[model samples]
Target: MIFYIAKRLGTGIVLALLVTLITFLLLASSFEDVARTILGPSATPETVTGIMQAKGWDRPVLVQYFDWLVHLLQGDLGVSVYTSLPVADSVVQRLGVTLSIIVPALILTAVIATALGVWAASRGGVADRIAQGVSLVGYLVPGLLLAIGLVVICAVQLKWLPATGFTPFSEDPAAWVRSITIPVIVLMIGGIANMAAQVRGRMIDELRRDYVRTLRTRGIPPRQIVLQHALRNAASPALTVMSLEFIQMFGAALIIENVFALPGYGSFAFNASLQGDIPVILGIAAFGVLLVVVVNLLTDLANGWLNPKARVR
Candidate 1:
């Protein structure tokens, strides 16, 4: 297991480095323009040149990259061009807000989806029909539409929750929950829909395998055969789908945050992009790549544990 984990970690590290390099190169293409944007239009050419030189933009590309990478390793993501705040600090603060909702939503998604899927596979009838209906609704209904409708019913009309704004958990835990409830629900629905379908399909296939029949013939408990053997085998694919869903949730969170007026990493990144704040943009890009690498690495580890055959390959 240690060896397996190490190999996955190594691969993730390499992928992260490659992604950061590519992202840096893309951002570097307009490096000078970033300085110009910072200095404003009225600044003279010499002033811009002076600013660039001070920032070491005059250095070789490789040198600048290495310097940036070193700073990143030191937890310094540079200062935002517009806000002049440390990118790392801003990202961490906003990321906390995003994760507050995303983590809970993901947990709910995993539990609910796994249960619905396993139930549908084990007892095909109304359970199967219900799971299928959920899958169809998840596929057809857009998250944004659901969020809007939820706000209208739950927040606007019903007044059960706040329509906009967020409260920090540290400040008021109950208020924080109320603020993120709609957003979490929106994210959870989409995730459950996608992962439940994947899990149900995988579970159904696993239960039909010859091993399952053999186990049944051997007088093994039905629950043990289904839960321990079949579900374990089926989990790898569902886990993979869940990891991908985690990434997709971040994308969807952008729109959901806007609707709820929650200040999160998505809203922060969006505003940074609009202002072309290169430092913040680059910082966000690096964070995104790192996130993907970490999620994939975790998924690989979980898959390997569930299916030892994966460790060999």
Candidate 2:
């Protein structure tokens, strides 16, 4: 198990490096333009040149990447051109806000989606139809439209939650929960829609396997066979789907954050992208890459745990 985990970790590290390299190369192609954008139209050509040289943007792309990588390793994400704040510090603050929504939503999504999928597959009648119907509705409804509808009904009409703004959990846990509730539910709807379908399909396939038939012949209880055996095997693929959902949720959260008026990583990244803030954009890219690598690593580990045979592979 330790060796397997180490292997997965090593792979994650390599994946992170490769992704960052590719991202850096793409951004570097127009590296010189960043100085002018930051300085604005009124800035003289000499001033732009000076700024570029000082920031090492004039260096060879490989040299710049290595320098940036070194700084990244040292936990220096550079200062934001607009705010002059350290990117890491800014990201950390906003990341907390985003995680406040994502973590709970993802946890609930995994549990609820798995249960719904398992139940639907095991019941194999009206329950299955109901689950399918729910998935279809979730897929058909645009997330932005869904978020707006929720804001209208829940926040505007019913007055059940705040319409916009956020509270830090450190200051007021209850208020934080209330603030994040609607956005979290919006995120969950998409996650559950995607993951539940995957789980249901995998569970159905597992239940139809010969091992399931043998278990039935051995007089294993239906619930035990389905939940303990088939569900465990089925969960490997669901875990993969769940990991992918984290990235999708991250993208979707950008739109949701705007609708909900939440100050979060997504909002920050969106603004940074618009302004062509290279330092902030690169920092965000690296951070996002790290997150994806970590999630994929955890998914691989979970798959190994669920199926010991995977450890050998």
Candidate 3:
């Protein structure tokens, strides 16, 4: 198990490095374009040259990359070219806001999806068919459209929640919930659909296994057999889907944040890209890759715990 964990950690580190290096190279290749955006098209060649030289853009690409990497390792993500703020600080602030929404949404998604999946799998009647239909629709609908529709119905017409904007939880918890409700619901729909499908399928498979029949023949209670035996065996796949769902939701938050006008990492990265804020862009990209690696690693460990066969190697 330890060896497996170490191997996964090593691989994750390498992948993170490669992602950051590729992002840096791609951004560096567009240095001139970035400079033009920063300096304005009306600026003369001398002005561009002066600005580039001041920013050390004249350095060799390898040297620049090494410097950036070293600084990043030391927790310096550089200053945003557009915002004139430390990239790390800006990203951390925005990420905090995003996490506030993501954490609650994730918890809700996991509990509700898992419950619905187990229920549908156990019943396997009209409820199962209905769940499948809902899951298909939820998964097929585009996130942006879903978010907008929810806003129109729940926020605009019904007037139950705020339509746009974010309020920090510190100032007013109720207002924060009201503001983030739509975005969280939007995130939950897709996550629940994906996770529930995986869970339901796994649960059904577990229920059909020989051990489940043996338990039933031994006069074990149906609920105990399903909950204690089937659910435990089914957990590995469900966990895998949940972990992947987390990554998906992280990516989706980028678009959802924009739709709801939340000042999160998604909006920060989006605006930074449009404005050619290289430092901020790189910071967000690096953070995202690291987050994926960490989540995957954690998921692998959990899977190994749930199913010891995975750790045998």
Candidate 4:
């Protein structure tokens, strides 16, 4: 198990490096005109050249990347050109806000998906068909549209929740929940659909296995066999889907944040990219890639724990 974990961590590190390197190269290339954006249209040629040279933008792409990489290793993500704040600090603040919404939504999604999936798998009648239809619709709907619709119905018309804006959890816990509720629901809808579908399919397959039949023939109760035996074997695939869906939820947060006017990593990245704020943009990109890698690693570990056979590989 230790060896497997080490291997997964090593692979995750390599993938993170490659992602950062590729992102750096792409951003660097597109940033050739970045000095103009920073200095404005009225700035003269010599002014732009001087500013670029002073900021090390005139250096070779590889040289700039190495310099940034060195700073990154030392725990410095560089200073944001727009805000003049350390990129790491800015990202950390936004990340915390984003996670406040994501974590709870994830927990809710898991509980709801698992229960509905297991029940549907066991019942396999009208409930199963209904679950399948809902999952299909949920998976197909765009998150931005869902968020907007919810805001209109719940916030605008019904006046039950705030239409836009965020309140920090520290400021007021109740306001924080009310602020994030719509967005969380938007994220949960798709995640629950995807995870539940995967869990349902896997549970069905596990139920049809020979061991399940043997357990039943041995006088084991259906509920016990399904919950204890079948569910365990089915968990690996459901976990895999959940991990992938979590990443997707993060991506969806980009649009959702804009729709709801939340200050989060997604909004930070979006504004940074538009302004050609390379440092913050690169920082956010690297942070996002690292998160995905970490999630994948954790998922692998969880899979191994649930199914010991996986640790052998």
Candidate 3, residues 92-123, lDDT tens digits: the string is 99999998888888889989889889989999
Q: Each model's C-alpha lDDT?
A: 0.88, 0.89, 0.89, 0.89
Candidate 4: global Cα-lDDT? 0.89
Shift in Å, residue 175, candidate 4: 0.5
Candidate 4 lowest-lDDT run of ten: 28-37
Q: What's the lDDT of the predicted structure labeled candidate 3?
A: 0.89
For candidate 2, list the clashing residue pairs, or say none.
none
| Candidate 3: segments with Cα more than 4 A from true spot | none
Q: Write the per-residue lDDT of candidate 1 for residues 164-248, one digit (tens) a residue.
A: 9999999999999999898999999979988999989999999999999999999999899988999999999988898998899
Candidate 2, residues 263-313, lDDT tens digits: the string is 999999999988878889888888888888889888998899898998998
- Give residue 11's lDDT in candidate 1 (0 to 100): 89
Looking at model 4, the pairs that clash are none
Instruction: Report lDDT (Cα) of residue 253, candidate 1.
Output: 73
Candidate 4 on 1-313: residue-level lDDT in tens?
8799999999999998888899988887766588887888788899888988888988999999989989988989999887899999999999987888888888899989998899889999998998898899987998878887998899999999999999997899999999999989999999989888988999999999999999999999999999999999999988888888888888878888888999997898889888899999889978898899989999999999999999887
Q: Candidate 1: what lDDT?
A: 0.88
Each candidate structure's TM-score, on Cα atoms with residue i matched to residue i, is 0.95, 0.95, 0.96, 0.96
TM-score of candidate 1 on Cα atoms, chains taken together: 0.95
Local lDDT at 204 for model 2: 94
